[model samples]
Target: MPEIKRQHGKQLFLITNTKQNCAFYRKNKFQQFSHKIHLLNRQPLENWSFVRTLS
Candidate 1:
């Protein structure tokens, strides 16, 4: 889990690279406001990339 600094409020975001969800978004996927989905081709202006990492 990670906290994204936004102008509105603090947004809790996560990156999911499950193979089952590959068709969902080719690049990045995120949520906005409540349960809305935000599919992004590139990453936002932040200190993170939309790449998968071993945890």
Candidate 2:
């Protein structure tokens, strides 16, 4: 992820499927960017978007 930041000079973005994972990301310094409902395997699921600024 750091490599991408070095190349693009932008923040890193990620989507995680569970709140627990989101909390983990938060603990690691990633901020919540947004939330969305996603369809997976014919089921609807909630996902969290997180971003870590590398610039």
Candidate 3:
């Protein structure tokens, strides 16, 4: 029936939307994690250089 088809289409759309949202969130989380790692790496290098300068 046409009504059944409409319902099926709506469900499919919802499923795809959720999938896209999940992928977007995963990418954001990865970027945040990499940024944190970059900051951590830079901090140690900066400190080492500062210590070397002092010595």
- Go through the candidates in order and give each one's C-alpha lDDT: 0.36, 0.86, 0.28
Minimum summed lDDT over a 10-residue window in model 1 is located at: 45-54
lDDT of 3 by residue, 3-41 (tens): 645555322111122334545544433211111112564
Give the Cα error of residue 43 in candidate 2, in Å: 4.6
Scored by Cα lDDT, where does model 2 land? 0.86
Once fitted onto the true fold, the runs of candidate 2 whose alpha carbons sit more than 4 angstroms away are 38-43
Where model 3 places Cα greater than 4 Å from the true spot, the runs are 1-17, 30-55
Off by over 4 Å in 1: 1-14, 27-55
Order of quality (TM-score): 2, 3, 1
The TM-score of predicted model 2 comes to: 0.69
Candidate 1 per-residue lDDT over residues 1-55, each given as its tens digit: 2322333344334444343444343344432222234456764322221332322
Tell me which of candidates 2 and 3 scores higher on lDDT. Answer: 2
- The TM-score that candidate 1 achieves is 0.20
Q: What is the lDDT of residue 25 in candidate 1?
A: 38
